[model samples]
Target chain A: MSQKPEKLIDKKGLRLDGRKPEELRSIKIEVGILPNADGSAYIQQGKNKILAGVYGPREMHPKHLARPDRTVLRCRYHMAPFSVQERKSPAPSRRDIELSKVIRESLQPAIFLEYYPRTGIDIFVEILQADGGTRCASITAASLALADAGIPMRDLVVACAAGKVDDTIVLDLMDTEDKKGGADVPVALMPNLNAITLLQMDGILTFEEFEKAVNLALKGCRKIYTMQKEALKAKYESVKEVEE
Target chain B: MPTFFERRQLVTPGDLLAEGTYVTGENTYKENNKIYASRLGLVEYEDKKINVVALRAFYIPKLGDTVIGTIVEVGFSGWTLDISSPYLAILRASEVLSRPFRPQENDLAKVLDVGDLVIAKIMAYDRAHDPRLTVGEPGLGKITRGQVVKMTPTKIPRVIGRKGSMVSMIKQETGCHIILGQNGVILITGKSLKDEQLAMTALRKIECESHTSGLTDRISQMLKKEKAKQKEEIKNESKT
Candidate 1:
């Protein structure tokens, strides 16, 4: 690994990745990638690679846990052994468990679980690679997967991260900036509803800086929301092409 | 009042369809006097109402619709059927047995055992209970032998086409009996295995490319081509 740069923001007022303060990383998202799962999606943002799959609104196993009023939403966030510089254990670690819960909560707001009572919908997210903001990306992909599964949702959820570096706020913090920067904030949003479903902060920032980071992150989220819709439409457009 | 998208336009969840007095129909929600799509589908305008035709969805059993399912459990009073839905369907012994059912004297599994496929009609369905199915109706009973093809339930209407034109064309071309189930289960049966295989292929094609135009013509051509290929194979075998 290269030595940490002394300044995350260079003299040109750009991030280490040569992006402007409010610029997001390159992101590519594909929906319904896994045919076996009811719905699935893959997302790549910068160096991060994540796959999310959704199953059900089907009958719940251990029927006692099934809710009478609405479908139960479950999620699992796992990291691959080769996803990082150090091999991560395949077992669910404390961070993975916590992230799974956060991701599920972040996604729950979008899905209309009441449509299917006495049922459960399961979302599994596998982090093939991790840079930073895996939780945000996972939330983005999981909601898209839920939509692809034909699950009713009030809105699609998208996420992005911003952080403070050298007294300057920047959008879409990468792994190095997150580890070395002053503060990191990840945010997930339902763009149309103007609702923030997930918000997390690490390190420290002043009140004004924090506010600026959140606003920047939200702007990044809104940008990604458009791509999320396009990915869903592209899935069917490709199928239409296959017909011709 | 400006509608964001045209009728039949593809839309994703949270897209504003219209911002006016348009009535919100199925798969849509009204908020702040705006109707937004709640699912990824094609927008539709039905008189004063706006609805979305979902491209893919699970089978939610509706009353009087025919469905095919596999028996998963044989209870004392009823049989549990897996109809590829969030809820399992229930078939009472009274619905199947012509005579009065006596639990001790009669065996339920003997009639419709687990894993047995059956074509039935949805007798009753509500949010409170599992769908109740009855199999005593004419042409609805145990599926003895045939090929089964599964598809997205939302695409079933496409498989049927406009007023049953596509299905009837398939039946005529492949010369097979096709039973279209609302639960996305299809049963194909014919005199020969080749004929059944041809019908299954045609149905699968229809399900995959259901959104495209000229689908009926495509399915007709597909079935006819397969039929011609099967005839040629049979002729070559006789010569050999």
Candidate 2:
């Protein structure tokens, strides 16, 4: 693949973010962070701030399209007006709707929806700040929100993006790398089972390079899973002490 | 079993798990083979799944929650209230259980005009539909005088505490009759504006610092200090 000029200054093979090609960004996750929703979470990966709120498993589905066997996962991904350099419209545009659909699909396999047959789980993800890898961050945030809402899940979905930049594969691409680099690939993985729940790629890269990028993203997912586990544990411990 | 915090535990973002073994309908769960509990509430649990709910110290209105709102807008058959929710609540003409008084065409606003806050309850919710509200009680009309402050709805439960403990403490200290709106709006009617402002300030401080340990004791001490300071100022003024 023909790569763009290098934006990351590699010192001893380490990128500008002080991370090696195989290292992921620093991630933070919290569960039950929102007041109004059944479950909610806030996640921050470097400069990214994503808040995901989960409502439902409620019986109030659309009257016309009610299903009896499975719960519908309605996902909405929206960027706050102040999330990016340019202000986005408050209303969900076509791009937002498409992104929502993709996210909903990606999460469907992880949730045990049949447990709440005839109900629906609505996951709303709002990006307070967007640096890069928003889609993957949303996936991770939504999973936590769902779990916070106490929805059953086969496994937590961990997501992170990787790409080829400056003729080298990088894990967990930063905002600058995503814009100026080549062959960006975002992947969501069931880290416990090592299964890919979602995958997307843009830009140009050969099959061999793509495989390397995928491997890097999967490794990032595992790292993220550990962070997610710690967040939930801390929240619980704090509350338990209060009760005791 | 999760390890106990021998000292104060400072919780950060990356400390909790996204999913774990939760006993359904319980507010606590097990993550990494360790059991964890919720600080605020157990919202719901079902089938080995549990959800922890957070309590807000300030009041914010939710659909169908009963709240004391103020009539800020008077329309044809209803009045608009300044509930702390995102949407303003409306008390319809029919929902007003008053004596047989036919409201005149132009008298709608006259009966309940702007600048008047009321105490009404949210009767119905139209998530995509309009909110239907009601003021069917004696004290549900326009609020003539009071000061208002906003806080998160989730925080209201904490501020109220278990069976109104926190609110009663504030009321006894300030000698102010406080009306808490479900939508994070608080109305404080004191002997004067200064007193009202002081009460409001105290409430806001409490909301912001609710999660801190020894909150109730701290607030009580703060209130006592403020009272003593005010008493000293009055004494000095009298001597002068």
Candidate 2, residues B40-112, lDDT tens digits: the string is 3324333444444443222323455667666667776677776644345678776763655466634676666
Fnat, model 2, is 0.00
C-alpha TM-scores of all predictions? 0.95, 0.62
Give DockQ per model, in order. Answer: 0.79, 0.04
C-alpha lDDT of residue A168 in model 2: 92
What tens-digit string does per-residue lDDT give for candidate 2 at A1-244?
Answer: 1355455647588777788788777787888778888778999998999999988766445744536666777888998999988788979989789889878888888776664445567899999999888999999889877766656565677788999878899988887788887779999887654578889998999999999888888878888887886776566567546634
Clash counts for the predictions, in order: 0, 32
Off by over 4 Å in 1: A242-244, B235-240
Residue B148 in candidate 2 has what lDDT? 76
Residue A68 of candidate 1: its Cα lDDT? 89
Model 1 agreement with the true structure over B11-126: per-residue lDDT tens digits = 99988898888899989999899998998998889887999988888999999999999999999899999999999999999999999999999999899999999999999998
Interface RMSD of candidate 2?
A: 9.5
How would you class the docking of model 1?
medium
**Alpha-carbon interface RMSD for all candidates, in angstroms:** 1.1, 9.5
For each prediction in turn, the share of the native Cα contacts (below 8 Å between chains A and B) that it retains comes to: 0.85, 0.00
